[model samples]
Target: MIETIVLDIGETITRDDRYWASWADWLSVPRHTLSALVGAVVARGLDNAEALRLMRPGIDVAAEYRAREAAGRGEYLDDSDLHEDVRPALAALRAAGARVVIAGNQTVRAGELLRGLGLPADLVVTSGEWGVAKPHPEFFQRVLEVAQAPARATVYVGDHPANDVFPARAAGLRVAHLRRGPWGHLWAGDPEVVAAADWCIDSLMELRTIVGG
Candidate 1:
């Protein structure tokens, strides 16, 4: 039985439409380059400090691009409300006696976003604070340790294929892919990630069935 559920914050729990565009603009790289950089860092087992040292220059360019885009549109990016079903789904999981937490790459600002949404997570793991990002083993390891959860007993639910599904699977946690909505397009075309999932669902509500909570 799954005793705990760990979620990724950005796209999984909260629905922010501008995230990708903002990120792409912020880092001055195409969306695919951000994906590739994440993969490269994880593949090389580079820690946050080192990865930043190598990628920050390029990332700065991206960030500036994003800033300019935001200014042009008179739009400032921020986290959106929790998915309609998130609170109810999480409450149900809690009622069923499972612990819930969030694991993602976030900064202090992001933590505030969770609080504003009223998400029922018992723990919050941020790569921004951890100095590492997902798809890296350490990111999951630290979160698991913080949650005091055994890998086999915990299930992680997220949106990204490499950052969310694959590494969580490698860490020995069962994975649920949140496969719909904006980010849904990212997964639909990727054969490797689609094939790797233990379970795939279009919404967080579907998790209740898989883990029997």
Candidate 2:
């Protein structure tokens, strides 16, 4: 009885191909170079902020983002940026009376942006708001508190194996590993991660069959 479905924002619901491209342009670096930097940062377990600082010393990454927002640039996720399946899937789950939550490793503006975009979500939680990020037990605990549902009755859907699947499972929630994202494709063949998830999906539409919306 999965009464609630928690989802990851980036890669899972929101696609940031254009956003990353803009960031590369701002930094005057090639898109692939920026992608490699992101991969290296993740591989070495470094904070994204720290990675950016290394790339450009004395530049405030947050401030640059704010400036971009102010300048009507890469500030938010447009309809074009959202994965095609997100809206209908979310609507189906809500129609079936399942609570839908967006809890992901995102900045403070993430919730605001999602809300402003009018995404179908009952609650939006971010690492910036929670003061802790994923892979941390406390963060998931807070989400559960907001959900007010038993862990076994909740499912976390995300692309990151370590950040979303494993930690949510450790927190006693069922996990769904969503393929087709950075972390998804990166860790695709890992038997430990794939086997650990209760479900693996290439599209959010698959969730309809698994959760029976």
- Candidates in order have lDDT scores of 0.69, 0.82
Judging by TM-score against the true structure, name the best candidate. 2
* Model 2 C-alpha lDDT per residue in residues 1-213, reported as the tens digit of each score: 778888988899888687678888877888888777877876665655565676788988878988887877755667888899999999888888888898898888776777777888898878988899998999889878877689988889998877888999899998889987667877777898877899888988787666673
Overlapping backbone residue pairs in candidate 2 total 0
The alpha-carbon lDDT assigned to residue 167 of candidate 1 equals 93
Estimate the overall C-alpha local distance difference test score of candidate 2: 0.82
lDDT of 2 at 130: 87
Query: In model 2, which runs have C-alpha deviations exceeding 4 angstroms?
Result: 40-54, 57-74
Each candidate structure's TM-score, on Cα atoms with residue i matched to residue i, is 0.70, 0.87
